[model samples]
Target: MSRPSVWAPKIVALIKGGNSSAAIAQIKVAPTVKDLQDLRKLLIAANLLKPHPNVDAATNDMIAELSAPRLHRSP
Candidate 1:
């Protein structure tokens, strides 16, 4: 993967603060769908996020994606 964006650390901080969705919203640039997905993966790998039972399938997929070794690097 390419070098992480400058916003990566900021996003991680928000996730660690337990406001992941808010972190997503804080992005200034128009990130692609995959970029947001990868941010979730980073949060998961950092053990700062978890799957909520009440969430939809897409969230569950994000949780599951981190359960596996998809990310080449840690957050």
Candidate 2:
């Protein structure tokens, strides 16, 4: 199994400390989709964020955009 990210502890600390705005700012620049997904799970688990269809749709869209193959033109 892979080790948890370093950011996980920091973000969780933020959540626990009621520093959601800082946590959200960190989340916005999460380096990977996995990070974003993990943070979302954390937020939901902490009851700081509620599940919603729009949020789900936005997550799916972000995943799609980030994972989609990029087209490269031959030089």
Candidate 3:
């Protein structure tokens, strides 16, 4: 089984405590794209963040970059 994320609880606590800036900082350094996405959802659900066009575009770009297949060069 997969291990739990280390940042989720901290982020949730920060959100609940109305510390959005700190939560955003933690989200910035989240280990995986899935973590980032999940944190974004939490922020939205808490009304701390809104889904703006620019933000969505940037997120989509990040998701694309992070999830894109890598090409291995011949050694």
Candidates in descending lDDT order: 2, 3, 1
10 residues in a row with least lDDT, candidate 2? 50-59
* Model 2 clash tally, residue pairs: 0
Write the residue-wise lDDT of candidate 2 on 3-73 in tens digits.
77877567767767867667666655667888667766765776655534344445456667667786875
Worst 10 residues of 3 by lDDT: 51-60
Candidate achieving higher TM-score, 1 or 2: 2
Clashing residue pairs in all predictions, respectively, total 0, 0, 0
Q: Estimate every model's Cα lDDT from 0 to 1.
A: 0.54, 0.64, 0.61
TM of each candidate vs. truth? 0.43, 0.55, 0.52
Which of the two candidates, 2 or 3, achieves a greater lDDT against the reference?
2
Question: What tens-digit string does per-residue lDDT give for candidate 3 at 1-75?
Answer: 998676756676776786656655555555778876765676577665553434344445655666777687578
Model 3, runs deviating above 4 Å: 51-75
Q: Between which residue pairs do clashes occur in model 2?
A: none
Span of 10 residues, lowest total lDDT, candidate 1:
51-60
Is candidate 1 or 2 superior in lDDT?
2
Q: After superposition, how far is residue 66 of candidate 2 from its true place, in Å?
A: 4.1
Q: Rank the candidates by TM-score, best first.
A: 2, 3, 1
